[model samples]
Each structure stands twice: as C-alpha cells, then as structure tokens.
Target: MANFEEYKNIWVYTEQRGGRLMPVALELLGEGYRLSRERGEGAKVCAVLVGSEIGYLAEELYAYGADMVYQMDHPLLKNYTTDGYTKVMTDAIKAYKPEIVLFGATHIGRDLAPRIAARLDTGLTADCTRLDINTGNYMKYLTDYTTASSSGLEANDGNKGLKQTRPAFGGNLMATIVTPNTRPQMATVRPGVMEKRERETGASGQLVKVKVELCQSDIQVEVLDVVKEAKELVSLTDADIICSGGRGLGNAEGFELIRRFADKVGGVVGASRAAVDSGWIDQSHQVGQTGTTVKPKIYFACGISGAIQHLAGMQTSDIIVAINKDPEAPMMQLADYAICGDLKKVIPELIQQWDEEEQQ
Candidate 1:
C-alpha cells in the first residue's frame, strides 16, 4: 500500500487559455479552500498551473484561497497536448503526492484526468456536482477492505476522504463516489456548480516550480493552428437571466416569443431538450443533463414540464420562474413564482407592462 501519511494538501488543476485563467479553475480553488477548512486545520489548498509564461498568474490563485501554487511552465506546455500534459502532470503528482486533486470538467480536464488516473493506476470520479468531506453513516460503507490494495488511504479515516457526488442513472439518481484507499482522490466538477470565494485582501502562497523531462518525440500529435468559433449562439452558462422554452411553445415558431421575452429582459434564450429534439431550437440552447448545466441569476421556464434531467441542470439557479398552464407541473411547484396561464398570453402581457413602466 502507498504511504498515506506522506500525502498532504488539496490541489486544483488551474487551467488557463490564451494566458488567462479559466473561471472553473478559480471555482475549484474556492472549493478546495472550503474542503481544506472542513477536513482539518493544517491541510493547505494548492493550485497546479501548467503553461508557458504563466508565472504571473500565481497571484490570482493565492487571492482565490490557494495556499500554494505549483508552476509547470515550459514552451512545450503552452498549448494542451494529451501526451505532453499527461506526462508532466503524472510526474508532478508522483513527486508532490497530494491528498486530493480537483479538475474542472472541461474538454481539457475530461481528457487529462482519466489519463493521469490510468498512469497512477487510481480511480477518478467525473462530472461531480458536489464535493465534501465524508461524515456520518456514509463513512461506515468506506472500510479499509473496500479500498484497492494499491490505494494509499488504507491507514486513513474515512471522514478524511473526499466525497465526490454526481447525477447518475440518466440523471434520475444521485451517486457519491469515494476513493478511500487512494492517496490522491481525484474528481472533475462541472463549472458553475461551485462558487468562487471572495478574493483575499493581500494573501499570497508559496510557488513551487517543477521541471519535467519532455521532448518533441513525446508528443504524438501536432497542432497546425487554432481556429476560434464565432459567437452566434447564446451562452446560457454565462447568462445572468435566461428565458427558456419547452414543448409547450408548440413549435419552432414559439421560440419567436421566447426570443422577444429574452430580449426584453436582456437575457439569453434557453430550451428544454424536448424543444431541441423537436427541432424547435438548436442544441446549443439546450439546458439540462444531456446539455450544459447553468446557474443563472434568474431562470424563466416557459411551457416546460420540468423533467428531472432538466431540473438537474438549472435547479441551482438563484431564482426560477415557471410559466405553465398546468398548475401541478413539477417546475410550477418548484419555481419561486408560478404563473398558471398560457405563456403565449402571459409573456406578451409581461413585456407590455414592462415597456409601459419603462416609458413612464
């Protein structure tokens, strides 16, 4: 068994793009800080940044509660390559031996995390929506015998293990997976699921520079150029207010009204999976389990039945407004405000009233 006592601190993979840090990375640092406080008094929160000329970004990590920042900077590490990044990350993990590692479940993280887990021969929990230090009866299920022989958590208490929870069974159920025997319990959390802590007034952390042995031969693929996609579609994840349509809109034409409502509120348009599948809207506007998870400030659900899959995505929104003729619909019951009327009629009236108030 690996030595559990040797592992220390919670590490967050601080991902960056075009020299700027991704919001999800900072969000993970916030969560790591919270997890450190919850786990005990002495455990530190660390940020592992891998890129070219990103030494200056370490300050942002410290401000977001990172007690330490691990810098793996090199020209070869500028852009993300599965093989090159995986090699350096694996080497770092072997050397530092962190107790927990958090990655944002972005395209990069999803690809890199599994590779690291495979190299270390450890378990990885993906798309985690919740993370906490395990406690109570849940700890009973986590016994030394349940852990793999290669796991480093054999001598540790179950309470100290990271609890990684995600929606499973097609979003019908929630499951919490743990790596009790593993030295570094790894998880990839969805963006916006965790809140970023307030920046510290003048906090800073220790910066550790890691030099990895890498060469051109190690990279199997070559990048010719990076093409950026046009921003024609609405970004529901970053939208403060969202006006989403469902099957209730009846057809693709129904979205015309949803668009108007969204425009009136200065919000973006979202759609239920049913709407996207029905060809009423594009899949980019889909909001639910199979689509993007959003935590907007205000979410307006018009004509949606509020399936469990859909609710799993937007339930975290600060405020939910359900507009459905069916008073007993799940969204209606769960919404902060429910309007038991046809959205076709109600939406126009709402817009008209807002316009009138604005004119006055």
Candidate 2:
C-alpha cells in the first residue's frame, strides 16, 4: 500500500481573508521552507490559492517562500463559501499532485483542511506540532504533544533521518507520529506553534493563472446578501493584554473586578473556562485550551486555574501574570509572575495604580 516513487514535494494551502493574507499563512510558509531544504529540495513549496480575481496574491506568496503558486481566479470565488473553495482546491490538488499538503489550523483552515483530505482519500493529522524526515528509517513523522508514530518509510539511499516531535496528552509531553502507510501525507498546524524564518529579499517564483470552467447550474448555494455584523464583541484573541478571571474569582462581583481592571489597563477582558461555564462572564472572553488561543504581550490570568488546554492557547504569549489565592494552583506554576491574594482587593489596587501611573 505504499509507493515511494509516487511521492513528491510538500505543498501548502495558502489562505487569504478578505483578499489579505493571514499571519498563519506566512508561518506555514516558513516551515515549508525548512522542510524542503532539509530534503535537498529546491524549496518546492507550492501554494494553492483560489478566489475570485485574487490571483494578484501569488507574487506575495512567492516572496514568502512559494516556489510555485497555482491560482484559480474567478468571479464565483469572491466569497468564501464552502462549496466553491472545496471544488477549486480539489482541482488544484488533482492537477499539481503534491506529496504532502499542509493547512494552517486557523479559523478558515480548520474548516477547509479536512474536506480536502477527504476528497484526496488520504489520512489527515490535524493540529500537528512538528514534522521531520528520517534518514535512518526513511520515514516521515507527524507528532504532537507526547504522541508519536512513524510513516514506515521505504529505504532511501539519498536521505538523512526522520524524527517528528509534537506535544502529546494535552501539552503534557510530546509524541512523534510517522506515516508508514499513506502518500501525500497531510497535517494541519496551529498558528504560533512554529518559528518564522527570514523573508527572502526579492524572492520571486513562477505564477500560473488558470480559469476553471464552470456553469451557473453547477453552483448550489445562493448568496442572497452579505449582512455584516457591525457590533464588535470584545475578543481576547486580538487583545494586546488580557485580564482574565476564572473560578477563583469567587462570583459575578469578582468578574466585574476583572472588567474594571481590564478597562483601567486599556486591555480587553478575559475569563477561564470555569468562569465562562459558570455564566459569570460571557463566553467570548474565555481563554484556554477549549477556548480562544491567545498570545497577548501580557496576560493577567486573575483567579484562573491553568489547565493544559487553557495553557495550550495562551502559553505562547510574551508574558503571563497569574493571580490567585491558592499559591499551588496550576496557573501559578505557568505564570511569569504569580500574586497570591484576594482578587477583589488586589484588582482594585491595580486599577488605582494604573490610573495613577497614567496621570503621571
């Protein structure tokens, strides 16, 4: 069930939002750059971008590491409807026929990767933390957290070694997984999971503009209108600093303390899953493994306990400050600084201090 000759270069599904590129796209490109070079390949990193008249993005993708950009620009592709994207992406994969496909585990990526994998009839590993080529075993490994396995690679006289490492058991440890079976091996990676490489100064590549043939009857979803919601809910994902509350906050009043502190610091409000589940705060503000993954410059995890899932999202932040009465809480262990005391009193003091500092 395995054929080494059928494999080819690694590929990436470069995603665009409102005609603008998401940060995750660049991150994936950076990784592809590393993987391709290690295999003595010419960074054969290819990008498949499909949208209505959006081929203009190919140049930018090349600058970021795309050796070749396959673009399908069309009017029907303007909006991100599942049907149109799936069809176009499926076509791109069929035509180029890459050995591996990488999708960013972002808002759109999470939705798109699996469908493409299903269409290709290949095994897809979602949220992979790392990828590597093994020369000793000639296997490709996809691993996350402490979970690992091998691709059961074929013997290669022109190779190095393979060792894929990733977080396993909810960020507790790392395990490496190898595909011993499938071709065009696939993996979806989370944003901020990997380091970004230096950009190529004036890096240029080949670009192809292809128009896919389609009929009006082929389109099933009708776009009546685009009702854009103007009301912006406070989201921690985009916040610079988040003052989050959790079960340790005591009750509604404690959460209110967080809101006040957040306001004073000019940061958005946030909460742990415990606070959100208890209805003490709106679900939008939750930050944890099961909630929004945030990498704020500074995070004030007030009264929240740090579970692995919660840390999984926010652990990538520049700095973490946790507050809780229980010194032994998990949050305290992960924080850059921990304060033990009642948040009700501590938060008010912080707000006052912030105000005084601002006035000065």
Candidate 3:
C-alpha cells in the first residue's frame, strides 16, 4: 500500500453552469470544512473549480469555508461534457493529490464522478446522504486482529479515513463505507442533505490557477447552444414547505384536496410513488427512492405511508406532519405531529380554520 501521508487536503468539485455556482457545491464545501476542521491546520478544505471565466467564484468558495481554490479555467471547458470534464478532473487529481474528493449527486455529477473514479482506479460511493471523518470506532474491532489473509494488510491509522455513509438496497437501509486503502476517498453526496455554511465577511481563500492541455479533438461533443429550462418548474428540493399525498389519498381526485391544502398553506404539492403510478400526479412530484429527495423546512404527509423508501427521501425535513386515519402507519409514527383522522374531513376543517383566522 502507498503511504497515506503523501495524500493531503479535502477537495470539493465546485460544479457550475453558465458561470453560476450550483447550490450543492456550496453545501459540499460546508461539509468539507467540517471534516477538515478536526484534523487540525494541516488538512485544508479546497474547492476544485472547472469552468471558463469562473475564477471570480474563488472568493465565494472561500467565504463558505474553503481554505484553497483550484481553478481550471478554459474557453473549451465552459460547457460540461463527460469526456472533457473527466479528463481534466482526473489529470488535476493526479497532479495535486487529495485524500478525499466530494462531488454533488446532480445530473452532471452522476455522469462525471464515476468516469473520474474509473480513470483513476478508485472506488466511489454514490448519492451519499452523510459524510464524516473516522474517529477510532473501527480501531476497537481491529485491535485484536493482526494481518489480513489476502493482502497482508496491517493497521497504520484506522481513524484517519473518510466515512462515507449512503442508502443501499433500494433505500431500505443505510451502509457506511470507508476506503482505507485508496489514495483519494471519493463520494457523491446528495444535494440538500448537507447544510450550507454562512459566508464569512472579508474572508478569502488561496487561489491556484491550473492550465489543462486540450484541443478540439480531445472533446468528442460540442455545444452549439444552451437552452434554458422553465424557471417556474416545481422543485421539491428547493421548496420550503411540501405537502405530499400517497395512496392514502384514495384516488386521483384525492389530490384536489391536497392541492387545496397545499395552496392554503403556501406549500408545493408532492406525491408518493403510489400517487404517481396511479396517475394522480406527475412523477416530478413523486418523493421516494425512485423519486426526488427533499429536505424542506416543513413536510406534510397527506395519506402518505411511511415506507422505508419514502422515509429516506423526506425524513430529513425539519418538521414532519403526518395526516392519516391509521395511527399505526409508519408515516404517522415518524411524524412530529400525527393527526389520526380521515383526511377528507380533517383537511377541509383545517382550511376552514385558516379562513377564520385570516378573517380575524
């Protein structure tokens, strides 16, 4: 095994598009700071930026707790392509060694991280919900053990690796993974799972500019133009409050009550997989293992059964209110506030109360 001491610093892939930083990048940088802080001054939190004319984002990274920013700026690299990004990022990692690299579990990140990992011959944990540094928990298990039968491995520093924890087995359970033998521990974290750190006033990080050797031949794909998506699209991850309905809603028309309640509460409508499959609502509003993950300030589970898959998506909400007639349902049990009653009657009653309160 190579000397782990040679690998230094924690790096976050600061993903951007059209010169705008993604929210997940800042979220990961905040987590990187937390992981590096306990390791003392030697382990620095660095942001690996790859885009054209995005050098100005260095200060933003610094403000969010990045100690250093590595900017690989080029006109050809403005738009993200799997071939172009993976090549430059893999090259950068080889030049500047990082013990752990964090990437957001976004569309681009999902495509890029795996390729980079394969090129470098490293393991990657994808869509991780949590990340932390090891702190002597595994040392006790290895204390009585000696040499490995296969690789003849011995414990040097058991508490010094990055702890990558993620949902596994169709989101039924969570598994924690550690790459003790790998040079750079890599993981793709889900967006909205980690909280963003507050920016510091007048704080700045060290900027390191990197130049990549590239040509038109190197990029297999070319960007002719960029088409922007609708600005008013419903994003559960970005919403403050989400009112979700499941099979408990009874039928497609059940969603009408949910929509009314959601509108009254100033929240967006979300759907369970059952609701979506039954054609009650669009898949865009589905929340589960196969659906979008969300961590809203408040979540209302209207007729939503708390399946492990569904819980995995929205359990992180700060406040969960479950409305179901069955008190024994998992959703009701996990909720901060559980209303054991018929939603048909309860929903209208609540709306009526809201109307009265508004009149007062």
Model-by-model lDDT, in order?
0.88, 0.74, 0.85
User: Candidate 1, which segments miss by more than 4 Å at Cα?
Assistant: 134-158, 233-235, 325-328, 357-360
Better of 1 and 2 by TM-score: 1
User: Model 1 reaches what TM-score against the true structure?
Assistant: 0.88
Write model 1 residue lDDT over 1-360, tens digit each, in one string.
678899888999999987899999999999999888877749999999998899999998999999999999989988889999999999999999999989999989999999999989888999998886846423443442124232344334556777787887656477889897777889999987788999886788799999878998999989777777775677888999999999999999999999999999899999999999999898889998878899899999999999989998898789999999999999998899999998999999988897999999
lDDT of 2 by residue, 259-346 (tens): 7888788788888788888988877676765566688899998888887767777887889998889899888998999998887888
By lDDT: ranked, best first: 1, 3, 2
State each candidate's clash count: 0, 38, 0
What TM-score, over all chains together, does every model reach? 0.88, 0.80, 0.88
On the 0 to 100 scale, the lDDT of residue 343 in model 1 is 97
**Candidate 1 local accuracy as lDDT?**
0.88
Clashing pairs in 1: none
Compared with the true structure, what per-residue lDDT tens digits does model 3 show for residues 51-133?
A: 88898888889999899999998888989988888888998998888989999999899999999999888889999987756
Q: What 10-residue stretch in candidate 2 is worst by lDDT?
A: 137-146
